[model samples]
Target: MCPHFSTGWGNDAMTSTIVFDPLLPWWLIALLALVTACGIALALVRGLSGWPLRALAGAVILAALTGPVYQQEDRKPLTDIVLLLEDESASQRLAERGETTASAAETLAARIEARDNTELRRITVPDGTDNAGTEAMTALSEALAEEPRGRIAGAILLSDGRIHDMDRAPDMPAPLHLLHTGRSDDWDRRLRIDNAPAFAILGEEVSMTLTITDEGAAPEGVRDVPLDISIDGDEPQRFNVPLGREIELPLSLPHGGRNVLQFTTPYVDGELTDRNNTALVQINGVRDRLSVLLVSGEPHAGGRTWRNLLKSDSSVDLVHFTILRPPEKQDGVPVRELSLIAFPTRELFLEKIDDFDLIIFDRYKRRGILPSIYLENVRNYVEKGGAVLIAAGPDFASADSLYRTPIEPIVPARPTARVIEERYRPKVSELGQRHPVTAGLEQEFDGEWGRWMRQIEVEQTAGDMVMTGKDDRPLLVLDRVGEGRIALLASDHAWLWNRGYEGGGPQLELLRRLAHWMMKEPELEEEALWAEATGQRMRIIRRSLSGDIGDVTITSPSGETFERSLEEVSPGRFETQFGGPEIGLYRLENGDQSAVIGLGPAAPVEFEQTIASAAPLAPMLEQSGGGALALEDGMPRIRDVRPGRPAAGRGWIGLTPRGAFETASVTQTALLPAWAVLLLISALVVGGWLREGRR
Candidate 1:
């Protein structure tokens, strides 16, 4: 309980505030009053005739103890605060709504300022961050919190009423009214992507969910709508689909990387805006986990190089087998001890060779462990869209070299039977500087690669020789064999770089790039076009081995084409950033190569519901006794209304003016003088004593 208290709660413009200054503590004063009342009740209950007089004298004494005062305030009345919110979000800026909002805000400000004892606060709410759309309710709540609640008479909002955060609307201290900004007949057709996968495997059907909604008094009998669907900016395919129903569209990506899929409808006459008629969806195409077969012939130092590289990648499924002892090796140990299980050469190279994406032959040579027919099947595997990498040791230059076998057809280089045993730094050839696989490698390490101990001499017969070893001999050669690709490394001493013997070069990076190039990763292609986007900004990149790269042609989803030139930042990479891109799919092409990427989500949250809607604000307005009025009808007049009464009528809205004021003066005076109270109390007590004595 508090030690002190005041009785000064009731006050108004007409009535002087009643206050008290008691001589004792308020709790003690209350106790004294309670005891006197109890004593009076007891006398009355006992049928005493003098009880009434005694009670009167006690009341007089108590009244004088409480020092009552008249608090007549020289009130300086405060002006009523009115919050006017202007919604300039993306949805509000559509059509004539923006202009209407501007005009209404000006007129409202003038009318409010013209009124006596009224103040107006205009708040402009912008579009929410990250496409949260119109958050007018959030702004209103903040504005309400900044002002005194009693002083806030009303809140006015000018918008199309397309608020997205009504759930966060605050409890109103006064009426909240929204003056609608758009025409009554405003209608729009929007395409919505309800569900889209962020990533999907290439060459697989992606189930894309969507909807076509006609909002705000759409034309009657429009049961179905015609949509133009395009993938990667290809020629659109027209199809009629049912309206107002969730659609399941099946789409497939042609290549790995980002694929732009666009869905659009014709903009017919009478629609409010055409921006919502189209939508864009970008899905990243992913390559399925690669199956790589690594065959290591006999235990060697560099056998685990390819195995470790392949195993490190989560996307690569590696099947590795190293020959510990050939059949001719006669160690005094059981055959079962020498092998975990019998080698399944037929199962790998013959039966399921097509399942593997890449095959690595590390220091492999024919030892009659398997017939020459098995090696021929390996050649057939390459011709049937498979990749093979040959990391040659001394065995590649021997009599049993793969160049003498059926695999010679795909070998880009033939061994010269001379293993140069001198340390030398390998170098990228002039052609390698332009190829995507090795283009920027020299610049990464400043071309400071560790020296290798030995390299097999090779004569390049076909394809490109991208690297050279001792005395400019071909160290790495790459070529395409029918539907597959092959890479031959003349030296097995790349392990030296991985060992950091002379400050390890980019062995892991080079090998990873090489493996991806062999497996046909889109980013490693020599001739390609692609782009990366951050909002409406994009960096269009063109990679080409040829120096003469032409201008890149950019095609918007709306069918308008623009050309932008490229600047070469590296040997093969050409790129430039383009800004102010509209929200949709974009097609980039440079005659020889082409790519497609979407800049933003197909349907912005603002355009998702283009038609103005007051439904979102209904709960807030209902609780505050406010009503919605369309701008098509006309602006409503502001009126004063008593608190708790309905604040909206036919053509006007009401604001409650709380007569808030500050007290400037107080006059404390006794209701009766202390001498008069004493005299009255003594007479009443004497009379009561005389009456009791006579009875």
Candidate 2:
């Protein structure tokens, strides 16, 4: 091996020195002054003076080239001992790994701190966000930069042996030692979803891939685990999941809505923990086809409203059931004695109740023609995930209104027989402004909207009053009973608004939303709870008919509680967002109102289970010739293991002559004095001038 050498004069001790004096180089200055004087004299006499000018210029250059520089002197050398410390991150926080690290750290710190001629510095690491493990390599690089390379003795790392930023690790000034924190028994079981999509079309089947792995400390055995999956708030399906393998599960959504699919694995007896057992995913289902059943009591101007609304939708399958005339109505009729055939209430309401997506009752009254049993069947249809809409005219407020029938039990409002005939423009209530149904529709009409000639005086009960007519009375009512939805448009004259009676309103949009909400689309829900997240920051929003909401109790991924009251912005919607602590599945619960949302992956702190093992970091750590040693092996006492030599071995390589420089003071000495520099420079200048003078 080549011995270290200093980049300076070898074997030479003393060099000549010249004292600082302006007169030492004054001869050159005087020569230049005399040359210039002669040049000026010759120029004034109009003779050849170029020779004197050149001489003067040469002298000036000579003086500047001979400036002073101090020479090296005898001095004491400093043997700097660089302390390269590697920190243990969350990965190092493995179950028994941390304890191993603590013992190794104390031993190494004591050994280095007790050294007499050395100093010890530490690079500590806190927790990292996301899944990035401890940046021990990066921290070491920065610490190395701030310290002197010549003083670096070696580097000591106390970690779970897991480092993510190996590319940023700096070339060590000395040997690097990795005292990993972990035991041979260190192991973990993690739940991982190998694949998932952002959105799934409604009524369509989607597949998700999942995997379960047994990490370090995991027992070497095959076991069956319970994995539960749920869509929306429905009953969960459980499976006897196998460990250390990949599985594919097929999921089918029943409706067009936002399904929050949760995948959970029951905690095992010997498992590290259950922090990673649950995961939440939000998927939006697409609605491409709509089946609408339009029932018309009598053919009127409002009959066109129902037809126009349903016809506007190309995907809608409209089955219109218009009772043109009751079976009893006969005006001089012939043999049949009936103007119209009997209505198919049985087949429509019972036989194929699920075929139609939404059923509309337009100005239908309690006409004795349809039996109460048929109406009761309709009520059951509404409860079984079916949509219903009611467009009431004056007949709705009368004794024959459906509100007076068995259907009233599911109706959101109680209709008053009093008919409001005054023409006035209908407007969205405060709640409607933020409501998905009427939110952006108001901006469509800049001027005064046309008016509706007649309105029903209805008292809203369990529904949302999105639109108001005649002094903010509920002109529209929407409610949800069981798993289905209902929308009530009190005024049949809503079509009159489209006729430009006063100015023409957003009649088309209002009716369109009314129909869509009845279909049970998520974005159209009157009461909703959802969240949007970027990194650890989250913005939570809640939509409800309640004017004021209580504290929104938030359950963090680590099972921590964060509560805050939501601000009521509209008549129905309340909202708030928070910068959460860590990443994972977060739950929002207000009283009995509870919702689950995902922030990041699992418990952010132990996402990777920081344990000082060489498995994950072998490739990079081996490049530095640094071998990972388990702290459970009883820290192989820190030794000055020469570079390129085996860093760790059987017996502890304890630092020699411990605390050798404990009381040693550190002081920096100047290599040369100002006077010595000036003197040395003068001698060189005089010597060069004398040699040139001889030439």
Candidate 3:
């Protein structure tokens, strides 16, 4: 945009324009000329024959007063620029599309360079950040701004028509040609997650809607395809789902925590790629507010330990009842002095017993309070998937111990009718170190566990002995009834740890782990296999109650299997980290335990549409006077075409050659010398006088 001159496109450029610099004001010069003309006209009209020579002399004088100049410029021509945009995003790498694109680009570049005055600006479109897919049009718009619009003879793109940003396409000054890569018959099947919830109840059925879409043309006779579904990292459950339809699948999670669910369709032989054939959804399993029923025979120091732990958790609803007045303790103190809510025994044990997630009994000795029928109902509750925990004291060893009643069948251990009262530190059994509830507890305290002055002597009848008190007697036991789980803490002195007695052990940590284990949390499972993915890296974990396990078998999304030995970093835990090479689903197996995790995005935008089509760029090509020609036929021939003519044909594409340049030099010369104009005017005047005198 130079103010000196405007440009004109050609092989070489030069320009000229008129500029003025007058010796005298234009108005005064015009007046003098008008007066001279009138004088000569009067002489001619009055019959004087000398007016013609006088008029000629006057014209020469007027011309000398007005100075005139000529101007010219020199310029150098510039070469034309043609954009060659190549999309290298993930979609272009599928099948042989990448090879075809790369070869075609090389051929086109050679041909364009061979042309007389045309050069190529190669722009590569890589994967967009945050799954934006192929940004071919975005790159094109940026390249257009870098160079002169007129100089850009044309723009050529090489891609698989999976561009994500079509709305960002720029206005083209010249034609645009698309050397479309990928075959027309290229087909693929992608699993799409229509709707998925981020959090689901553990026991409730998690419903997810999904669709099986076939891009391009799928193989014929493929009505029902096999879909594999997995929860956490367990073995996949295969089922037949119809193609191209929305399917609602019901899922069940065994534990409350983060759960990874993968739904994948097996790759057919002729499908484009397996990358899009699978989808991964991570739904965290959350427990609905836990309803805990705490029934204490008499309020003790250890009762608040259980109450505080359950109350501190925002997701727990606690219903505690302490029997202040037993059936035999009829004291003279009136009921008006006591502060308590009505204890609805029948409602708790019969009417709505199943509503509670867990029932806790602390130091209860029957005392004829709950009739035998109510105790039988409590036993039946434990056999029907209900969880019950008993914290025993001296009452457990008395004649009326709960083990001597109908509830004894569900108790993991029975009292020996003896109570040991001595200062002794509690210790974890050998099997406890491997069990989920007590695992790593000893390590946490590291021989600094507090001592308990009291422990109820009990002999294991069933279930596992996880903790021991005085002289290796059972301190804690866990067992599974018909369809439920029950735990017995032999001593009620656990509150000693809470009071920091003798440098308190991990009282809160131990209680938290025990509660979660009783509620069946996945992370507290004794035997499990799972993998976690962050970006492209994956961490595979194996937890077992036994010694070292074998190597885990890793199966990639493409069904390629390999083995890697896990490192033991803990007592019963083994794991290893891997940098995934591709973006897709990964399955890991160690013996019977298997897990599935997604390494990258479930379905990348690049693979969402794999087939190459010209429909996306149809309007752009038509507006730019270009055509979409497939590279499958052959590499298009490069040729020079007029700016407005059709730039692409069956086997050829075109570039417009704009001879653009810049001004290199300029010069100006005056029309005539001042001295020469003066001499000519005087001679003309003298000749007119001499001629008039002779006449």
Q: Give the top-scoring candidate (TM-score).
A: 1
Q: Against the true structure, candidate 3 has what lDDT?
A: 0.83
Task: Give the alpha carbon lDDT tens digit for every residue of 408-479 in model 2.
Answer: 889999986799989777888877776778876768777778777889999998877878999889988778
The weakest ten consecutive residues by lDDT in model 2 span 655-664
lDDT of 3 at 200: 90
User: What overall lDDT goes with each candidate model?
Assistant: 0.83, 0.69, 0.83
By TM-score, the better pick of 1 and 3 is 1
TM-score for all predictions? 0.80, 0.69, 0.73
Greater lDDT among 1 and 2 belongs to 1
The numbered model that scores best in lDDT is 1
The sequence of per-residue lDDT tens digits that candidate 1 reaches over residues 1-695 is 11323334334243355667677887887898999999899999998889988898788778778766544444456789999999998888778888889998999999999988889999999988767888988998898889889899899999888888978889998999988887778788888886788889976899988788888878989998899998778899999999999999888887677777788888989988888888888788988798888888867667776677778889989998676777667767654456777778778878988888888988888776556888898888888878999999998999988778889989999888999999999888888897877777877665478999999999999988888888888998988888889999999999988788787687887888888888778799877889998878899989887888989998876678988999999888899888644667777788868888877656788887777768888888999998888877888988999988999988899998876666555554555667887899999999998998899
What's the TM for model 2? 0.69
Task: Estimate candidate 3's RMSD in Å.
Answer: 7.0
| lDDT tens digits, residue span 1-695, model 3 | 12446455665566764444568999988999999999998988876667777888788777766766555677777789999998888878888888988898898889888887778899999999767888888899889888988688999999877678889989999999888886768788888986688889878997878888887876777788899988765778999999888989777777677777888888888888888777888888888888899888777888888888889999999998777765555776554334465568788888888888888889988776677888888889889888888999898899988888889888999888888989888888988887878888877775588899999999899988889988998999988898788999999899999898999888788777877777767798778888877888888888987786999998876688888999987777888988777777788889888777877876777777778888889999999998888889888888889878888888998888887777788767666577887788778778878877887
